[model samples]
Target: MIIKTPRLKKGGAKNVYLENVSHAVTRPAMESRRVQMYLLMLLADTAVLLGSFVLAGGVYRDQWPNEFAMAMGWAFLPIFLVIAVYQRCYSIRALDEVRYAIGQAGIALVLSAMLCTVMIFYAKAATEFSRVMLSLALVAAFAGMALVRVVMHLVLRRIYGPSVSSVLVVMDGGPKVDIRGAQIVHAEDFDISGVQSSPNSLDRIGRLMRGMDRVVVSCAVDQRTKWANVMRGAGVRGEVVSTALQELGAIALEREGGQSFLVVSTGPLALHARIFKRGMDLAITVPAVLVLSPLLLLVALLIKLEDGGPVFFVQQRMGANNCLFDMLKFRSMRVEKLDSKGARSTSRDDDRITRIGRFIRKTSIDELPQLLNVLRSEMSIVGPRPHALGSLAGEKLFWEVDADYWQRHALKPGLTGLAQVRGYRGATETENHLKDRLEADLEYIRNWSILRDIKIIFATARVLVHPNAY
Candidate 1:
């Protein structure tokens, strides 16, 4: 009876197993680092707030927000930044990866931008402050905060192990069940993750499992033999119970130390293709937004003045995994209509188009507002087109001949892609054309790259020039 004692509690962050979170429960080993990470982010956010204050000349001038109010404004910047980080964290942490911490740095910047926007709205700071300087500072804070977290990751990795956590157990049933159990036990902590195992030698395995705070065994392991059952009975009194197979995929591992055993598994979002797609999206879209801002605004105003209506139009669109976002586009339709409910595709002689609206839509100027969508992260520079999941096209939109359908939306929906550059635009009236566009979309997703996007944009430039008069 080498009673094992497990350390980790259930509901850990690494595993996305269950979802009743007052926030993901921290495992024992991470308790300290988790606290440290929060504190560090708080301090870093405070620093950024102070920097914003300094940039605003220490306070807003007369008729503007004053010193104390400005200080409070600085304070809210962090409050909002932290909240934004938290909202992004739910999915971001579940999909834990090396790149996530880096990507989150940008998320932090976007939060900061929103906070700044609020500040500008309230006139809490200098009206003439340069957007360039603010952007630079936000970028700096993102880089600095992320660099710190990476250092923390490295330190924790070295201190703990190059791995996450592991669990091992040694069960003795009969000679029949003994060999299989022993082989599994022998694999030991080699997996070096939260749920690693080595069940080869019974004594060795028992020793290893007992070394942790808690250990679990499958119901099957109990039926090995009478003596094994007796041993398992004693083990059960002290340890937890779970299938041996379940141990193979533990995302979060609890640590109770050399004389203890505790096990837990939960969030596990970051995976192969998902990670790659996210990396590429971040690498390209962030810089593109900075470069394309002027173009986006120019087109926006042209739409507004031409149609005498709102510059941007937002419509519900299905996002990744059936999530929803208000997809943005420059309003390219007429504002004089009595009803706004039934607007659809503009055609060759559509009544909605103003002289300017027609030109912009023909040249795809209406799509430029989405560059801001890219900045806000609702869309991408190049990927599959997004469809409203409850689309008007009916179930056929998904089931109808687009073989690689789901894979196309695997990446962020883009403003332009290979399909569009290949001339798959306008009314998706026929099933064949939709199928062709879907095929092109899937091809782009399957083989995606910055160079490919550049190629698509280049081809689109050619298409825009001719305008087909439609």
Candidate 2:
């Protein structure tokens, strides 16, 4: 089963499906195990929190917990859960490593307690509750949660044995990888060629990968890109065994035993970072939309009244992961001369732009409709700007001018970005113009923070009426 070759017919390769090789491996689903563990920890922590508060009430007031203590318990429990989830306190790693579990639990508990205390103080309810009793309950809750994690870790280790995850190694005529406890199948046996693009090909690969936490494909150099694309589109951690790190644009290099593999597609942001970015986007975009709705309405009405054309100028642009999406903007071009493909950059006093268009373009009001894109999660308030498909830098397409241009799509396209704020707005008339913006975009991706995003959003306000705007 490790090195079985597919039997070729006269004209084509045989299609070997996943079911043909199903008997080779049988293992418990790692995802289900993690879910059960998460549920158990949630239940355990809730009990510990409430019980701690009740016991503290008995010690302090010499009675069962009254409404205040129980209320405090309920409040602290939700806060702790939110912080704990963000801190990955109930993650698979926490289950595996006792120290990490205890540390994250402690940090989450302390942060949640501090936040709860601040809320109480602001609500003027601090005087109504006993501080000593609250402090005592928090201390007891932390101790109990820590003890629970340690016990649960020991029990889970005994239950699941040594393997923390299920890994699938698909040997596709490359180097043979020996991963302990991993189910190894010859790619030919499963008809899993990296070049196979048929729906059934993906279905077969997915079925074989169903319960696996990670899929490692050891394939020929030429097939690496296809396999990487397949894995990127699939819902699992995928790695390809390759020494061509430079060609693959490998984010990180991994070495296990004597084998070196290139990790092509881990997501750009972590879970907590995604949550933070999305929260910030909503925080700003929702209020901005509400405050600017009347202005948006006015702009739409004017555009419609000027030329009786469509309100929006929707065009396909490259978005995150090089996918195309319809980006919206207020129509600023004459109906007949509208450049849907964006073949040419808008020059100063261009006839294609309507009289109303010129004013909105000058004031940057034409871009206001993209606020909806931000709300839709199709765009961000701060990111690399999405470009029209036919956008050119000098005589070449943007990608042809610089290979790294596509790397900017790793993050969501923004309504405004570091490049725009730095006066890289308007046309990319030459390769250097594109290069400068690309450099800023890549820099933003590399050093992203909520503070930086806020700063970019603020900076964008200054350049709303730049001279380069048509």
Which structure among the candidates has the greatest TM-score?
A: 2
- Global lDDT of model 2: 0.83
lDDT tens digits, residue span 200-273, model 2 = 77866666667778889999998788778877777779988875664786778789999998687666798888
lDDT of each residue in 1-470, candidate 1, tens digit only: 12132332544441222121101222234435555655665566567555554544323333242454345446546555566557453232412344566565556567667766776678866564445545545555566656655775676566644323322343332122221112123122222222223233343323333323233333334433432343453352233233453445333445565553334322222475446545666777677667877877777767666646788767787665546788776676666652233324445788867777677777777676676677677777677777654432323555454545665656678877787788777665566767878889867765565446767767776676444434
lDDT of 1: 0.53
TM-score of 2: 0.52
Clashing pairs in 2: none
For all predicted structures, in order, the TM-scores are 0.38, 0.52
- CA lDDT of each prediction against the hidden true structure: 0.53, 0.83
| Model 1, total clashes | 37
